[model samples]
Target chain A: MSDLADLYRDVVLDHARTPHGFGLRDGAAAESHQLNPTCGDEVTVRLHLGPEGAIEGISWEGHGCAISQSSASILADLAPGDSPEQLRSRIAGFRAMMRSRGEVEGDEALLGDAVVFQSASRYVARVKCAMLAWVAVEDALLKLG
Target chain B: MSSIAPTIAAATALEESEVYRLREDFPILREQMGGHPLVYLDSAATAQRPVQVLDAEREFLTHLNAAVHRGAHTLAAEATEVFEQARETVAGFIGARPDEVVWTSNATEALNLVAYALSNASAGRGGPEADRFRLGPGDEIVATEMEHHANLIPWQELAARTGATLRIIHLDDEGALRLGEAAEVIGERTRLVAFAHVSNVLGTVNPVEHLVSLAHAAGALVVLDACQSAPHRPLEVKALGVDFAAFSGHKMLGPNGIGVLYGRAELLNALPPFLTGGSMITTVTLERAEFLPAPQRFEAGTQKVSQAIALAEAVRYLQRVGLERIEARESQLAVRLHSGVASLPGIRVLGPGLGVERAGLVSVVVDGVHAHDVGQYLDDAGIAVRVGHHCAQPLHRRYGVTATTRASTYLYTTEAEVDAFLERLAGVRGFFGAAS
Candidate 1:
């Protein structure tokens, strides 16, 4: 049960139960739908940017595991008020952590509750689940430019 | 009365103890996964191979390894004999002639072979005889909504390539095909009707005889995807009256990289080869060349000789156990699984309800839980199941679900394993806080 507990931490469950910005926004300038074909999990991420290309708001709609849904919630909470440059670095850090094969210690200050997915890196099949929302946000941000 | 009834009764009686004995042959069943004894309920994805299948392949590679049908040397001749003999065993297992069985990479390629060949025919590759397969804008290709992507996509592509319309027979609420509409959909203009013998997702045992009759009535060829059925039931391609059928070896306890495509000899000979070059040619000049007759013409390049040998061993293993007995045992397992889960609150079982005859599998959706979470919970309990659309998205869409968690059984599956799976599934809603 330790492995399952490590993967489904309290913070992850909390975020999944009450995901931030779960509804779609009107006049969203950038959006992308990301699908994990293997599991059929899909997420459509929408981003509203401020004047300086800083993320003014973030929201998503999807049906997936707690990991993916919670990851999306955490992204919505963290992406707003960050400039595109800051968001890029944060995304890069998260991607690096996911690809670390459980070797790299996830940086909580940077990734926030999304750092709870560190244990998922050990399970090759689930890394994609943790990364689905992140990848969608990355795609949406790319569309912003 | 038919002799089939007595044989099934005897096999069912024997399988009461035979299934327990059969587990000893599969070594992996003894191992631990996720700190508990592994409960493999994902045989629909791919079956665990027995030591006999392993030994057969190893024996061939060690002693009889050589390029088949090529050389005058002793090893080459021996390999060729073994390869062709494996083909005979496979063909016999499905009640077809050895020449009617063409080997391919897997069932996916086997299906693509038929679709692509029909496309070739439409393009004037197989001449007049092949024109029976050709379709135009006014013509139609009939498929059911319950098809796996392997069975569905190829026909869709064929219809796209030709000007034929791709029509579907939709599923009812219980996931059964609305087969009453078959007469109307499979009209004279229908060139082909392809569907799964048993659905990978729903475990629905389709009315193959009825569907084949309808196709025949319209003078349309039938292509059966037996990936789910061939492993669990006794199949006779001739008796089923299908013009062509495709099934994979791995799902039937054989090695991967080997599959069989069964077709009527005349249709196969008329349909141009899907893959070309090497081994399949009868004569070769740079200017023009002639091809060999099927199943040789369909089998291009060096074949999966050892895998075919191992697959033959797998077929022999199933025969020794008796497919009827295996089917009987699995039906009981399916009943236990369905009834056990059906009693739980807020659990929606896909396909047929508890009492209907289905293949040895069940897929379900929890009221408030995602299938991935349910799958994770099961995995934690040492249960392995497939969680997704099960490669039948259109069927899942029809059921208004994005995904489902499925537990499928095999010849070696035990009552205890079914109980364990049900017990784990019973707790999924609670663990995810979806329970009332």
Candidate 2:
């Protein structure tokens, strides 16, 4: 059980169990369903942005493994309150981290809850699981915009 | 069967053992993955290559390799004979006559050929069955949600081209398609019924005979996605009586780049050639050219000479073990996998849960843990299982889940592997502290 912690870390599971802002908003600007067809992981992310293009709130309700759900949980907090431009930059940084083969060099703290999965770089398969919610949110935001 | 240690339970496990020993013929299984003995639970992706099959292809390329259906030279004659022989072996494996097996690049190409040929027929290029196979606005193509993208996409593209509507027989809560509703959906307007012989994602085996009969009653043709079923189970395609059947060789311990497209002679003769080029001609003139008869008309240019030979050898390996026994072994593996996961506290086994209904594969979702983490956990322990949608998106949407973790087995898998897999999965929730 060598730090089974790295693979299933407490921070990751906490967010998965108690995902922040994890519910569908009543009036959403746009909703998008993205599926990673390889292992059957699916997530339907809904975006509710303020009139000024700030992410008012974002939520997801779908089925996936803990990494994905927890990743979604972490994403919920970061999504709302940011201006569209800042949010877009975060998406770029996150995408770069995800697609990076190894060594996501950045302020790990800024990613907040997503930092728990920093060790995910070692496992390629789980990276998609971690990225599914993030990708869905980005895709939903873009589609909503 | 002769040298291998017999299974613990014969009548129950023997049938699967037949397939298991058959798996021994595949050489790659002897290798390791992730520094651990590869308990490959991912045969549904692409099976490992057997030694004999590998050698056969090697031997062909070294000595007898040449272009087929061409040349007056000695090597060409030898190459042509060997290539045709592989076709005969493929035909025999599917229980079809040699003339009926049309070799394509792979199953996808085979299906595209069928759809395009039908489209041509609707456009008045077909010989006899032209009107019979034609699709229009009034016509319908019915399939189940369990179709792999290979089967579903071609029909979808075909439906878009012709004015035909694509209909479906939805699945029940267990991820099994309601076959009875097939009778209802496959009616007069149903021009063709396309479905997977086995659900690639769910591991649910469809009733080919009943579906075929239903389609025939409505005067519609049936095409089978034998990609999953043909490799793992025993198939008598002729008896299955589909109008056209498509399956790739790569999934069956054979080489890539070759696939078997089994169609009835009468229907095949009526269908036009999908690919146009050298080697598929009867007479050529400056103005126009006449195409040769199928399986050659569909196989234009140079065929996968060595791969076809290797695939033929793969068929021989399976035959030696026997399809009946292979199907049985996989069924037992499926049952064990299903029960093991079903018993887990937060686990919900997808598709046809525990039964002979599922063909040696199980997809499940845990309450608290994510499938990817579970997959990562398993991979650490030297277990390899496919996680995510398994390529049937509609099936996932229907199940009301974005994805499910799938552990699929073949004859090569052992009970120890299944037990170890289940054990690791059981620990996932607790390790994450997400256990309720």
Candidate 3:
């Protein structure tokens, strides 16, 4: 269906193939490992903070479906240069979009490439896949706090 | 090595027309998925219920609904008689005495019952009667790497509680159990051997008789996880010489919330009850309560009465169709399933290789495409399959993968359905741009 195309857009596929900040890095402020027990997908996200506690870098490594891998890559791409508060707001926005169940169009300004997951939100099972990395990053931020 | 006589001689595969006719019995087959006819190939997860099973449950609830074994009224008498008859039917289906069959919520609970009962016995709950079931330091429990978590975790807990070591019978690269390792592992100190008759993920049927002989020689009890085999093949627990077995009803075209646990009558009567309350005891005082015999001792609280009746009807349906014929038909599908997927480039079929006589299911790993993506593509095409660790995380780890796409078949599964699944699966890699 067209919705399937929407879920796996060209940008998402590109990110999944060659994800940004794909490897776990050293000298991080905090790191968190999250597993999606339903499908055995997992991710370990490392967060790097600037001197003023702004988000400097986010790196992650994991194995999972395209949705999860691409979502992680997109999160890593958008998380830089934002404060922990800004990143938390982004996380909340992405979570709200996922929970919308196709009813709400995501804010492209806030979610950026992550808005492509709006189609994935229609699939109840795949919502977790899109959120796996975001949850890991959230956990990492909590650890930093 | 089975002592029970075969129900039928070797038979030819069911005709395509006959399979089509049988498919009519499942109303869900008529439903459409993603604007296409539903091609159900996930029977290993849970088989679609036939009309007979649905009617059996509704019929019982409409006419014979009553609390069984407690009331003395006419309705209660009728309900109890029907309930016991259902037990007899299930018992006969598995080649066990009626008294040896215990009703559980599902196979998980059934396995837990035995595990917790043994733990209770080890804690001196059943006194000297359950001495044979007790395990302490120096005792061992053996399980295989390919077991579903339901069968594996209970034994892990059992060993953790009793201080008995938990050993594993590793699998070969082909996904079959290594009987040599099993022989070495199941030695004198082994108190119990727990394994699945067929791997839920790999679909490789384990060597029941060989493992049974090994456990028997070690003077250890055998607990067979028959969840995968009982629905596809003729399972004679007594003939297999297993001391205990567990299987779910939903996987066999029966209703959910009902499962059967088969144990030797003497062994069941001796073990302490896991869930103690009303309907399972002989008498009770403020401080202590005496439990009843075998099946009743294990059945506590309100039972899944209607579900059990429906499961019996499901068993009767299988019997009437003849398990040998179903088995024969499924074997042909298994070959087709294995070869069809194996022939595809970059597709690695798990479990037995081509011509290796696996059960009627095939799980495969598409080289570059993740199983979830493959599963989603197939789902869009209205082809249902199971994709994940399939509750055997260790087996997946052994294979060096996190998940796999599994297509399983049953009596109602047609050749066209299997082909449809494969055709959709063949396109998954190309769609995902992972075609190598």
lDDT of each: 0.89, 0.79, 0.91
Query: What TM-score does each model's chain B reach against the true chain B?
Result: 0.97, 0.93, 0.98
lDDT of 1 by residue, B165-246 (tens): 9999888888788978877789888879999999999899999999999999998899999999999888888989999999
**Interface RMS for model 3:** 0.7
Ranking by TM-score: 3, 1, 2
In candidate 3 the C-alpha lDDT for residue B266 amounts to: 93
Interface Cα RMSD in Å, per prediction:
1.0, 2.7, 0.7
Model 1, runs deviating above 4 Å: B1-6, B9-16
Candidates by lDDT, descending order: 3, 1, 2
- Docking quality tier of candidate 2? medium
Evaluate residue B235 in candidate 1 and report its C-alpha lDDT on the 0 to 100 scale.
Answer: 87
Q: Give a tens-digit lDDT track for model 2, residues B250-313.
A: 8888888988899998888778777888988899999877777777777888888898899999
Better candidate by DockQ, 1 or 3: 3
Q: What's the candidate order when arranged by decreasing DockQ?
A: 3, 1, 2
If scored against the real structure, what TM-score would every candidate get? 0.97, 0.88, 0.98
Which of the two, 2 or 3, has more TM-score?
A: 3
Candidate 3, B1-436: lDDT as tens digits: 1223455534556767789999889999999997989999999999999999999999999999999999999999999999999999999998899999999999999999999999999999898888888899999999999999999999999999989999999999988899888889999999999999999988888889989999999999999999998988889888899999999999999999999899999999999999989899988999999999989999999999999999999999888777777887888899989989987989999888887878899889998889999888898888989999999999999999999999999999999998998888888888889986
Candidate 3 chain B — worst ten consecutive residues by lDDT sum?
A: B1-10
Please provide the root mean square deviation of candidate 1 (C-alpha atoms, Å): 2.0
What local lDDT score does residue B339 receive in model 3, on the 0 to 100 scale? Answer: 88
Query: Who wins the TM-score comparison?
Result: 3
